[model samples]
Target: MAKHYALASYADGGDWRETEHLYVPRRDTRLRLQSLMALGYTASEVAAATGLSPSHVCNLRTDVVHTTVHVFTADAVASAFRDRWDKLATGPQANRQRSKARRLGYLLPLEWEPGDVDTDDTTEMFLSDPSSPETTENPEVLDYVAIAEAIAGRRVTLTRAELSHAIVTLQDMGVGVHETAERLHTYTRLVNRYRARARQDAA
Candidate 1:
C-alpha cells in the first residue's frame, strides 16, 4: 500500500514539498578523494569501496570546476576515506596512482588532520605554489633520520622536505653538490638551491 502525506502549510497558506535531494560544496570531498589517490588507491579501488562508478570518482578527484556534489555521493566518499585514509594501497596500479598524485602535488593522508580537512585554509596550503618566494622563505622542517629511513627503503619516495634535508645533510658531510644531486636523483640546480638555503639559515 502506498501512503500519501500532506504537505505542511506556511503562514501564508502556501504548501511546499520537502526536498529529498541535498548537495554540499565539493572542496572537502575532492580533497578526500585526492588524498586517497595520494595514498596509492586507484579510482577503481575507491569506487569499489564507495559503490560509486570509477568515472564518477575520477571526475570528482580531478574536476575542480564543479563546485558542489550530491550529499549522498559526498557521504559515501567520506566513509571510504575514513576507512582507508591511513592504509596504503598495493600493486602496480596503486603505484601508478601514487605517482600521478605525487606529480600533481596532492597532500598525503598523514599531512592532514580530521579537524583541518574541511577548512579552506588547509586547502589553500595544499594548492599554493611551491616555487614561490614565500614558500622558499618558510621551508618545511628538516628530518635527517626520516630521510635516511626513506633512502634505505626498496622503493624510495621522499617529500620535498625530506629531499631538502637530505641535500643539506649530504653537504654537511662534505659531499659535493654534484655528487649529492646524483645520489638523490635530482637536478644539480636544485641541490645548489637547497644548499644555499641551508647556508642562509645557518648564517
Candidate 2:
C-alpha cells in the first residue's frame, strides 16, 4: 500500500498553488509603535491606525513580547503611519518648518560682501554630488526611507535638506567626515532599496 500527503490545489489542475505569507513579528510592531510615539503620536491614534485598542497598543509599546505572526495588520499600520508622517515632513509643511527655524536663527542665511565669488558656482559645489541619486531630494522618497530606518530601530525623521544640514553641523561639532559620509551612504542604500520595493509592490 502507498500513502500520499495533502498538497495545495490549483484551479487549472496543473500545479500546486503558489502561496505567499507575510509575517510581521511582534518585535517589529512594537518598534514601529514606539517610533510613531516618539514622533508625537498618542496611543489612541496608534490604536486606531493599527486596528487595535488603545490599551492593546500601550501594552505592546511598553511590554516585551516575542512572537511572529503571518498577517498584514502590523504592516498596514506601519504603512499608514509612514504615509501620514511623510506628508507632514514634505512639501509646504517642510518649507514652513525651515521658515520657522530661520526666523528663530537656528539656520543662518548666506550673506556675503560684493567681492564674494558667484553664488551659483559655490552653491553647486556645496550642494550637488554627481554620485547621489536624484530621488533623495524628494520628501516622499525620504519618508519611505525613514520607514525602513524606523523598523531598524533608528527613528530618523528628517528631509534631505535637513539631513544635509545635520551632517554639516555634526562635522562642525568635531564628528569625523568619514564617519558622517559612511552613515549617509548607509541611509542612501536604505532609500534605494525602499524605492525598489515600492515599485515592485505597485506592479
Number of the top-ranking candidate, with lDDT as the measure: 1
- Window of ten residues with lowest summed lDDT in model 2: 4-13
Off by over 4 Å in 1: 1-21, 113-116, 119-203
lDDT of 2 by residue, 13-54 (tens): 223323344453565456545544543456676677767788
lDDT of model number 2: 0.44
Candidate 2 local lDDT, residue 115: 30
Question: Candidates' TM-scores?
Answer: 0.48, 0.35
What is the C-alpha lDDT profile of model 1 across 63-177, one tens digit per residue? 9898998766776786677556534676579878878998998977546655555644334334344344533433445555667864443224565567677777787788887
User: RMSD, model 2, all Cα superposed?
Assistant: 19.1
Show pairs that collide, candidate 1.
none
Query: After best superposition, candidate 1 residue 47: deviation in angstroms?
Result: 0.6
Q: Judge candidate 1 at residue 40 and give its lDDT.
A: 83
Error of 1 at 140 (Å): 37
Q: What is the lDDT for 112 in model 2?
A: 18
